[model samples]
Target chain A: AQSVTQPDIHITVSEGASLELRCNYSYGATPYLFWYVQSPGQGLQLLLKYFSGDTLVQGIKGFEAEFKRSQSSFNLRKPSVHWSDAAEYFCAVALYGGATNKLIFGTGTLLAVQP
Target chain B: EPEVTQTPSHQVTQMGQEVILRCVPISNHLYFYWYRQILGQKVEFLVSFYNNEISEKSEIFDDQFSVERPDGSNFTLKIRSTKLEDSAMYFCASRAKNIQYFGAGTRLSVL
Candidate 1:
């Protein structure tokens, strides 16, 4: 079974400050990782995804994540966060075929940006 | 620009009553899914449907929970008997190939 672990439940970043959210997964094979954001009273929105290729993947709203296989981590980063970036973020892993292939989500990390 | 939309933004049902949540995924999407989030909990996958059959389902999707794509544009999840515990936001999602798109979600309350 593939699962995700987001170590930080809450993170506060000031406007113009860099942000990093930690995510770790447990999967037997190469994992398909994704980041999703949900604003207040909204549905989950895709940030980005990683299957293979470059270790660093860029996403919308200037978000990026690096896939580290050895550490089983896919950490999201942003050089400068805006006030509008405050939201709940989730990290998930997609199982390969025959393994159900469902996206299992993390508990989510709450981001608070101060202006 | 294409997005998944769900109907009955909020529903309040009595315990033991049946409730149906509807969704219209992106017109051309081939795969559909249902997920739920209990308050302060993770987004848990209930089931995934493709080719008119269930591709996969989690343990939380028991006999009480059922899914059907009655028409080309509609996908529905039905609960035989609603429970207080079932009171949560149920989200509908669609997938083109790899990434899934989610709907705004239906908040179901069982009193």
Candidate 2:
């Protein structure tokens, strides 16, 4: 079965420091990958997505993710973390040729930014 | 920027009571979906709706659950008999293409 895995359950980063959240996926074919961030009392916001082109995809809030096919990974990274960036991040995958494009999401990584 | 909207940010219900979660998807979107996340678990897909019919559903969406696009603007998920294990955050999403937009979920607490 296709699934997504986010290894880091919780991560703490100092404000202004760089950050990286790891993600791995298992699927038969090349699946569409995405990263979403959810703040308390808010909906999941699209951070970035990896489709057919460009290994590195840049998204809102200065977030970027790199999709590595050989490693079966799509990791999200940010050069500088902000206090407002403290939130839960989820990595999701959708099959390429599936009839109904239902998303398979990984257990999220909760990031806490320290001032 | 269009978005999907869900109602009743939080709901509390007794076991065996019926509960309906509501959503209003982006007007032009063609696909709709329901997903749930347990307190500390990954978000799981419950069902997908398109063209007023269910395109797909997961095992978690058993006979107790049903979905409807009542009036072209609103989509609803009804649980015939709520169970204690049904407590979770339910999310509504809509898609026009490859990207799916999510709404602020409704946290259901079944006591």
Candidate 3:
């Protein structure tokens, strides 16, 4: 079975500060990776995803993540974050094909942006 | 902008009672899924549906829980006898290929 681990439980950053949320996964083969953000009462919105090719994948909201195969990591990063960026972020993985293509999400990282 | 939509923002049901959560996925999406999240826990996968058949399910999706794509537009999750532990936010997700989209979610409370 595959699992995703987001080491940071909660992160607080001042507005305009650079942000990075670490994520690590344990899977046998290279899996489909994704980053999603959820507002306090809203649904999970996809920021970006990595299937193949580029190790550095760009997403919406000026956010990006790099997939390092050797390290089994897909970390989400933003050059500068705004107060509106404060929310819960999740890292997920899904299988390739026939084998139950459901996403397995990590515990999540709660981001708190201060003024 | 098309997105998944779930009904009843919040539902309060008694234990041993039956509850059905409804969802309307993105019109073009062919794959559908149901996931649950305990208040402070991770989002857990319950079942995945595609082409009118089940692709996969998790251990937490026991006999009490079932999913249906009854019509062309709707996919539903039915819990035969709800339990107290089942109180959580249930999210409906739809996917086409790798990108999976989610709805706001229905907070189910079993008392």
TM-score of chain B of each: 0.98, 0.98, 0.98
Model 2's lDDT to the true fold? 0.95
Expressed as tens digits, the lDDT of each residue in B1-110 for candidate 2 is: 78899998999999999999999999999889999999999899999998789999999999999999989799999999999999999999998678999999999999
Candidate 3 Cα errors over 4 Å, as ranges: none
The TM-score ranking, best first, is 2, 3, 1
Pairs of residues clashing in candidate 3: none
Q: Compared with the true structure, what per-residue lDDT tens digits does model 2 show for residues A1-115?
A: 9989999999999999999999999998889999999999999999999988899999999999999999999999999999999999999999745557999999999999999
Candidate 3 lDDT over B1-92, as tens digits, reads 99899998899999999999999999998989999999999999999988888888889999999999988999999999999999999999
TM-score of each: 0.97, 0.98, 0.98
Best by TM-score: 2
**Residue B4 alpha-carbon offset, candidate 1, angstroms:** 0.2
Best candidate according to DockQ: 2
- Clash totals, every prediction: 0, 0, 0
How does candidate 3 score on lDDT?
Answer: 0.95
Q: What is each predicted model's overall lDDT from 0 to 1?
A: 0.93, 0.95, 0.95
Candidate 1 wrongly placed segments (more than 4 Å): A98-100
